[model samples]
Target: MNPPTSTWWTWLAVAALGTFHGINPAMGWLFAVALGLYRHSRRVVLLSLIPIALGHALAAGSMLIAGLSLGLVIDHSWLNRICGTLLLSWAAWHALRGHRMRPRVGMQTGFVGLAIWSFAMAASHGAGLMLIPALMPICSALPGAGGAAGAAGPTALIAAIALCVHSAAMLLTTGVISLAVFDRFGVSGLRTKWLNFDLLWTGTLAACGLVQLAL
Candidate 1:
């Protein structure tokens, strides 16, 4: 189904957000590498991507549910401003603290650990925050947008598609990067890169957040 006419802008925003997420240093391929190191098994390393993708999907799905339940409308510029402000605040905090973030890969390296780590990583970084506001206008503008609880079928479908597309892109991009790093530098090099770039990634997030606020 086509997105509501009035929500085109929202869709574009969400798509852009997805692209941004793909490029974000903090959320990039590094986590995959960390998982590889933790497991010390190439098979497990490859499998870890599954949980990370699922976790991201869950976070985005949760946001979509919240928007639908609240009858959230994104027509208001003020709400965008509020979201922007929040992002900026988060960025400033990271900047001030220099973001001593570390990958907490456990020894167990089981599915449970992978899932928990994936969820924690996504939530901590506000993975789906951009998608929420971006889809709000589209969902609210659809026909029978708020007519009944079940009226959100079309919008929900669109959201599912969007989330899938975004998550797939993330997995592919991250997976490739992880494999490349493992092939070239080995686990030691990957770990060293993660350690060195932690602050840089934090700064990048903070900068993006602030820029969103200003825009």
Candidate 2:
């Protein structure tokens, strides 16, 4: 067995995708921060990232499984349009109702609730879907990636490493940003600002989806 080749370009691609995903306002990191704020503990904030990372892993893993098992087929244009349209509809509904989806933080539920919420959010947004496809080629090129020989060791190792790196980057970036916002503005201030911007962000996502759909 040979050591799997590591490529800088692959790492960079993963980082880029993670960064891009981290900036999305609807991602669970924002809610993680809210969780931390609700508890008035930085410790809770840091701990909250665990569930977020797990959620990301779950999403990415699911995509990989689909691709490997059934050959995941995605029409990027169609998916984008569908996603965008859904976002837009959700936004419009919220706007009309003068309501925004807010993270629920309660003592009884605590960390468990946070984890479940993060998982659902990440899954719904297709957070890890893009990364898996982007990394698949590189992952498949590894020596053990093909056939039974590769399955037990090097190929699986490389895939796991890649997934870990990508997930870590996303979680770190999001966690830092969310924590910074909480520190600077405090919970109430952060909530107000996010709510105010939610409509705009939601609209933008919707428009992007629509454009993709149209294409």
Candidate 3:
């Protein structure tokens, strides 16, 4: 059977958000480009994405799992409000003190360090929190979603698939941008041609909160 319309939209929203995340330099592509330049190896840039993606999946997956658990006890409407409030608060915090939360990593950092940096960056940015709104309908659609005896297994499987889909989109976007910048533009141009997405990021976060509340 064809999936429901809401399911399609939820998947699309997850992917669209992933693409946005990949576009944001603070997400990891810029760091990947820098690392590639530092090591003077395109291969290094490609390899770095693995850890970055892994760290992001872990960070976002943690939130998904938490939300799934909470969905069992909390009403869907209340959950939405909770996530919306949190998203708004997070946006405000990001606007006010996000810079202080960004983890500093040197070019000489190893794979593990890069993963840790990505995790810290994603967590601070509330990347996973952004997924909750999309995740709600997904989990809610499953059989016995609210504390059902047999629902946990399918819910987890579906959540894993959703996370993979989102992460894949993010990885692909990040790889494209990273390679393009490293191959054609080089990082030097950033000094003169950087597009600051901080405001856009803040705005998007607020928008996501609004969406959650509206839903």
| Top candidate, metric lDDT | 3
What's the distance in Å from true for residue 167, model 3?
A: 0.5
Q: Count the backbone clashes (under 3 Å) in each candidate.
A: 0, 3, 0
Q: Against the hidden reference, what TM-scores do the models get?
A: 0.71, 0.64, 0.93
Tens digit per residue, CA lDDT, model 3, 1-215: 23345568888988988898889888899999999999999999999999999998889889878877777777788989999999999999999999777788999999999999998888888888888888788778776777656567776776787788889999999999999999999888889998878888888889989989998
Q: In candidate 1, what residue range of length 10 has the lowest lDDT sum?
A: 67-76
Query: What ranges in model 2 sit over 4 Å off?
Result: 1-7, 69-108, 143-154, 187-215
Candidate 1, residues 1-215: lDDT per residue as tens digits?
A: 66555645655566666655554545535566666676676776577778767776687667656545445343335555666666566556656653555457655667666666666666666666556555655565566764544455776687787687677777776677667766676656635555534455456555545545554
Candidate 1 positional error at 112, Å: 1.3
Candidate 2 lDDT, tens digit per residue, 76-132?
334444444554565465466423344555544566676676666665554544554
Error of 3 at 120 (Å): 0.5
Reference-based lDDT, residue 199, model 3: 81
Candidate 3 regions exceeding 4 Å error are 1-6
lDDT of 2: 0.59
Alpha-carbon deviation at 69 in model 3, angstroms: 1.8
